[model samples]
Target: MTVPTLTLNDGKTIPQLGFGVFKVDPEETERIVTDALEVGYRHIDTAAVYGNEEGVGRAIAKSGIARDELFVTTKLWNDRHGADESKRALGESLEKLGLDHVDLYLIHWPTPENNNSVETWEAFPSYRDQGLTTSIGVSNFDHRYLPQILDTGIIPAVDQIECHPQFQQIETRPLLTEHDIKVEAWGPLGQGKVDYADTVIGEIASAHGKSWAQTIIRWHLQRGHVVFPKSNNRDRMAQNFDVFDFELTTAEVAAIDGLENGGRVSGDPAEVN
Candidate 1:
């Protein structure tokens, strides 16, 4: 199965359908990650805040997969957003993952409320130069916050955000496209907040002989968004990656787009931070 790829701003290619370890328990990380690897997931997303880097590292080592075959992403957390701390936090993540370099490193949140986002954005590029991380980007950043970072003359390779049918990020999409920043969907399935078996998605799934999870993921892919759906359940992890076989029609895609309600299930980064 050949997974599709998205070219980053820096010209790096990322698997469009990757595996994510957002809430996977630390203790079960090794086994679950090992299973994901066995199931054919070459890209893995983790964060310093997730506290499961060690287990991910152990799984990668035990899987015996060649290092170049994997694409690993880790992030810098809110509290460690400044230049010096951002650099140190990435180093710590590298040490924990037991890898010399991460395929991508992200700013977990703008945390503008913390009043240190600028300082942190200023420091992100040094990672690419130092060879600590192959690419650098941001998460939970909106149209407002994104320009602030880009105005610094450094464009992020990707901008990951909470994107699903309910929260399509209508306004932010153009800004990202205009700047050549690839948009990645985090919480692609809405963190399971929206019922996957709901009528609309279910109907689409049944028509295509695909799972609702696969249908939603395909919607994101057709819209040119990179996605990583998290699932510790072995079968579902495999199911999520099974979306490469089908494609949604223009009307079917529009129907899904019409489901957007401007609702967000996750906390607003601007407010939370």
Candidate 2:
């Protein structure tokens, strides 16, 4: 099936639905990534800190898919939160991914302790200018740093935040919308922390004749945000990729939205930074 795509602020496009490798075993990355690729997923999300870029690279190389046809994304870790370290981190990530350039790169965190996100994000342009990364963005950045990063007049192409129905970015999404930055949901399924099976999400999934995971993924897609649902299971990976065939209704989307209770499964931007 053909996955839908979203146009970034920079005029570059990304698949709205992609596969992720958050906690996958490094030894199993190649096998799992290859599974995802064979399931017709062209977009793969990884990070240097994930310790699986090399395995992702190996799967791509082994797949024989042309470079331009795939969308690969990696990030700069929090410790690499500086101008110089940002540049070096991307270079190392590229080397590990076995690619001369990545489709997208992001600042992993705002690094609130040092408040150095602005300084680190400032170096993204050099990578774009150097042709090391086609597009650049940030992750886990809340309203606090959005303006600071944009004050430099360098708006990111996207901002990948931890957005799930339970913890929707009621505040951050609008700021990104105003700035033309795409919203990419990192844990679209709540890293399995979300109990969709016995909740309203489960009812929606039943109506659509789909799994809870597929229904939630459809929610993100219909909302016009980008999402990456990670799964090492081949069937589950295909299930996540098969969301394009149906669309959620307005009330269904709103019901899912109502499930929000200010819950967040991962590090909060306010506390983590």
Candidate 1 residue pairs that clash: none
TM-score for all models, in order of appearance: 0.98, 0.98
lDDT of 2 by residue, 1-273 (tens): 778788888999998888999999999999999999999999999998899999999999999999988999999988888899888889899999999999999998887888888888888899999999999999888787677888989999999998889888887778888988988998999999867789999989989999999999999988888898999899999888888778898999999999888888888777774
Prediction-by-prediction clash tally:
0, 1
Which ten residues in a row are the worst by lDDT in model 1? 193-202
Which residues of candidate 2, in runs, are more than 4 Å off? none
The CA lDDT of each predicted structure is: 0.90, 0.90
lDDT score for candidate 2 against the true structure: 0.90
At residue 45, give the lDDT of candidate 1: 92
Residue 255 miss distance in model 2 (angstroms): 1.0
